[model samples]
Target: MKLIVRHAPLFALFVACGDPPSDTGKVVAPDSPSVIVDTPKLAANWPGYYSDTLPCLDCPGLDTQLWIRSDSTFIRLQKRIGLDSIPEGIIGRWHVVNGLMTVGYTGDKPEFYRYTADGLLTVDEMGVADNSKQDWTIEKFADEIGDAIPRMRLIGTFTYWADSQSFQPCGAEFSWPCTGGMDLGEEEGEPIVRFNNADLQKAYKQAVKRSGDPWTVEAICTLGMGPAAEGDGADEYIFIEQLPRTIERCP
Candidate 1:
């Protein structure tokens, strides 16, 4: 069983609304290092992102996306949902260790990924295999609050569904998954089951008017690896775009 870590415990509470007993004593580290991401690069031939999970179709859990910056700052997003909402918080970062591109949190003590030149992110660091970096997904955001939180204003009764900006998941093996490499939902060749970015926004508004239920949406943005299942390494590829999720409504 892979352990799926969230962006922030606070975000979880706002979205899901049930705290495990272990959440009570969780201490917030006083000082976390600032993650200065410089962007990652994708294969010149295939410079785009994909979604790992089909959003709206598979919108109930953690959403993610793949991001490749120009300077070779490879990234994968986790704990994201929706594609057109505001952001709440972010927990992941991009890093390079010993010539390997890795994704992790910005912390004094953080998990790191070592990417192969091909760009498939994996874990060989020798710890927490159960929570290996491979288990993570990436998502693109419309805004910092696209990781939207549960909140209710005192004087106003504006219902805001939990949602995020635009993003995608790096797919198991593909390139330019969505239309123009973003979640347009109208990708002529995309799976019919997956919903696109526009549909996500439509759903969010409908939910807000109806019941303020937060739904998560995402695509697995990945580097081009293949039609062959035999290859698995960072060097294989990278991705862009992200899915967002509106978990719950804040009263």
Candidate 2:
């Protein structure tokens, strides 16, 4: 079975809250008489970030993590109930229309969201609230708290290749292949970080000193890109340590 490795354990707590019903409003046509004209502007803290466990009919629950960045980028990590698989993460653009947040996903219809002071309410494809599913919400997290944790792209459990002196990052609930191994070279006496999460760095420092195998402690790290391959593409991941950024023991 695939393992479920998360960037930080703190976010696991987001699943405990109860999300209210989605009575915010209904989707309307551009020229409809019922169109919401006085849409509320997004709150300054509305670059919503949340992680929660949602009620599931097929399984025990669905573990999900969501991040809506200031730059209109969105990332969501989701895993099914009772399945021991890496949580798949998707990153793309997000926009707000008529007080509803729309998340763009690849080859899939955009997911609509309604924001409240408490958390984000899930809207179905028909642009209506889905009351059928319980806990259809992700509690908002503070920006500093969210920033303290590494972005979804850089979160995962990894393995070390002693023979080749390489580090292999494995997917926790997703099926991502790390064709290019990770690099640990320092820049200015610190680990080269594209996505800097201060807490994550401390974990790496702790991992490096562990007497046991490296895989026994999961560390936030970056994918290696050769100097000749600079600007080839964005770095796949970055490590940010949170309070509960416990390393996953190798299974």
Name the top lDDT candidate. Answer: 2
Best by TM-score: 2
The global Cα lDDT (0 to 1) of model 1 is: 0.35
- lDDT by residue (tens digit), candidate 2, 1-251: 23444333221122324774353333333432332335555474667568788876788988887877786666677778578355545556777777678775434567788876668888865557875747687887656233422323343443323222223333223322232323347789875543333333344446665422343333333222233224555433333222224445422
Which residue pairs collide, candidate 2? 15-53, 85-173, 86-172, 86-173, 86-174, 87-173, 87-174, 199-241, 200-240, 200-241
Please write out the lDDT profile of model 1 over residues 11-112, one tens digit for every residue.
Answer: 222233485546655555443444455456433221234235422434454444555444433334444365434222222345555544445433334344
Which residues of candidate 2, in runs, are more than 4 Å off?
1-44, 125-127, 144-179, 183-251
- Candidate 2 CA-lDDT value: 0.51
